[model samples]
Target: MGTWLRRVLLGGLLITQGAVQAAEVTFDDIQPILQARCVMCHAGEAAPLGLRLTRLDELLKGSKGRPVVNAGDPAGSELVRRLKGISQPRMPMTGPPFLSDAEIALFEDWIAGGLKAGRNPPDTPVAPAPLQRPAAGQPVTYAHVAPIFASRCVKCHSAYGLMGSAPEGLLLNSYAAILDRHERVRVVPGAAGASELVRRIRGQSQPQMPYDGPPFLSDEEIQLIVDWIDQGARDTNGQPAPSPVGARVRLQGVLGEGWTLDSLPLVVGPGTRIDKAPEVGDYVEVRGRWGQDGRVLVERIRRR
Candidate 1:
């Protein structure tokens, strides 16, 4: 074989190897990059343009209009375009400390690699049983709504909690606290549609509630809150309204960073139980209370 032909063949082999290695870039490799640079705005209901970067599924599902990352096609991916400034309005909307070239390259490689989801630790637990809804005809009041806030709104809004500063001075930790805050009337008795709480959760308002989501509250959960507000937003025994229990989220995706499933953080503790060692791409079920930090404090996990 000619020396020149051998050099070309060797170069091709190196290129193929690089592609194969790039394909291995999974959620784990890219999650920190996202958490540090993207989640600030991309998290929660208020995420601009409804784009959520907290999970792979959210990225795949895209904004209310379209997908952000196009698997196996970094050049065509909106995420890539934004990072490279090929698209109008470059990302990290808060940048001067924009993603480094190396960081952006990681994302490019991840997309090129087919966007492999990351794996979980061996001891990662399975999902728990579904949350049971409150019995029919229960009065919607603080008793019912508090749990929702406990699991979903307190991490950021609580007077003292972790997961960064609360936005807009809003606090959802207790009944009196929420009702007493007149800075912005979040709930108006007998008017679900008029309530800022309802509007935010329903995406009628700019940015949404829960602030971190593509997995916004389920329809039933939203209805429960609406019913509570529509019935006069009382503490209890005022009137019957829908009351949903803690949410039980079951998803299939590679675990990434801490106890995250598909980019959604999971807070596991003494109450959490693990059945078997779970790996990346292993479908698992997680049952727990969704926290204000947008994490699930998993009580149980079932690997299938």
Candidate 2:
């Protein structure tokens, strides 16, 4: 009887230990939450405050000055404080729809259990699924290419991307924007080999794009983009290319405030004419088109 009771007690203890181990949060558990909620404002070079949440090393390294996460002490961690709003500017910096309570609790639990970085998480989000290539012989147009960009590139390349500033001032929002640049050409009609877009994705260029990778562009997706560029990278209508729009816009803040026109991101090109230096809240008329990278490339501007 004594031996049987001891055996039963041991079995109960083993089960309890397994339960405790299962309950402890690791980086893997909270990674999806970070990718979905945090990395948008905390990846790459344009990351605000130099805080990068994309990798465990970056998270552990914290922002420019101090650590964001404090292991074994959720109350003392800046990341936890920011999420809880005990710190200034409740995080995501672009929110009212902040991280859910359950999500925040996960971080709290992870930290309290001793922050373990765990293994790396998958690079892309789970939803919307991976894109399949369009049927063969279908004219590869913006339609075919947009999904590829939306899925892989736009997170870091769009105007509103978390990188704060899109790399190389590029914005991949529309075809007109994509083709209107004066800087190094991203795409050359009928020549995929010459297109920087193709080279980067194919890993021929320095710093192969989609910046986060190992799971790079699938061959079918790469072929689609190459085919589109080879086919002149046209809009769906294939009509004469649209010209940049001209507008009279008010400046909300100083040029140093980062250029904007009517709340849309703007870029001042060398060709842009400024009759007078505009100050914050000043009104000006400008002619420009959306660059391929999705910013308004100002060609001409004058006080209105």
Candidate 3:
């Protein structure tokens, strides 16, 4: 994440909710309206007037030459006229009126308010300081690993229980609970090649963690855990360190160098749909276990 990109993202997050609640013209509010109404015809190859309502940016920006709205000018905007049943061949060409009066009112109010940019708020604020990893020779203390777990893993694992089955008597809710497991599979420092914890994440084991969706941990995140374990898996109490291992599992992804990619994993994730063309040379990461013959059954996929 570059500083400028992070700043832009932060700025977007800071003002997104207030704008949505106050003005009502947010991506969250507008997206469903477009998808339910406009996307029927104004998407894919049959896009009308070169318009695509699949994304907020495209909707706000409008067609190739025509602007969707004059910001706050409903009267001057052609979109308003068409939706008001005044223009020829009205939108959502079939079925019931896709939007209620309240929904239309939102668009009107938003346009009248100068089409403000939307934001996605941060649930838990992350400080600007980069998270520090353990030193090469140091141990993976509970204090050090706990923060990382809390930041990433705990969101899903804490409540919905992605790591293991709750009824099966497995839990990672706390460091002590995790450490006291029957197999103690959490971490084994100084043995990077024998850790089941690492194996599950790297896709060696069945049914990956963060099971809610695709794109589990990025390579960087996986590397951080590996580095911490390689140093030594220790508790904050500075007791004897536990060993860690690296599984045979590997994560494969497309990387955009100076070359082009012809193919990539199109369908990944358990029982997920794949129905789009990946842009040529676009990078994607896939997690899977390496077979003896070097084949892999991809478990998850995400952008690189």
Q: Which candidate is the best by lDDT?
A: 2
What lDDT tens digits, residue by residue, belong to model 2 across residues 96-141? 4467899999999999998876765534332333344446655666
RMSD of each: 22.2, 13.7, 21.3
- Model 2 TM-score on a 0 to 1 scale: 0.45
For candidate 2, give the lDDT.
Answer: 0.67
User: For candidate 2, what's the RMSD?
Assistant: 13.7
**Cα lDDT tens digits for candidate 3, 131-236:** 4565766655555555445444443443333333442353444565544435334444553433445655666444565453376767776777676566565556
In candidate 3, stretches whose alpha carbon ends up further than 4 angstroms from where it belongs are: 1-129, 135-137, 159-168, 242-304
lDDT of 1 by residue, 52-126 (tens): 776667777888878888889999999999988898556554343367898899999889988877795422222
Q: lDDT of candidate 1 vs native?
A: 0.65
- On a 0 to 100 scale, what is the lDDT of residue 31 in model 1? 78
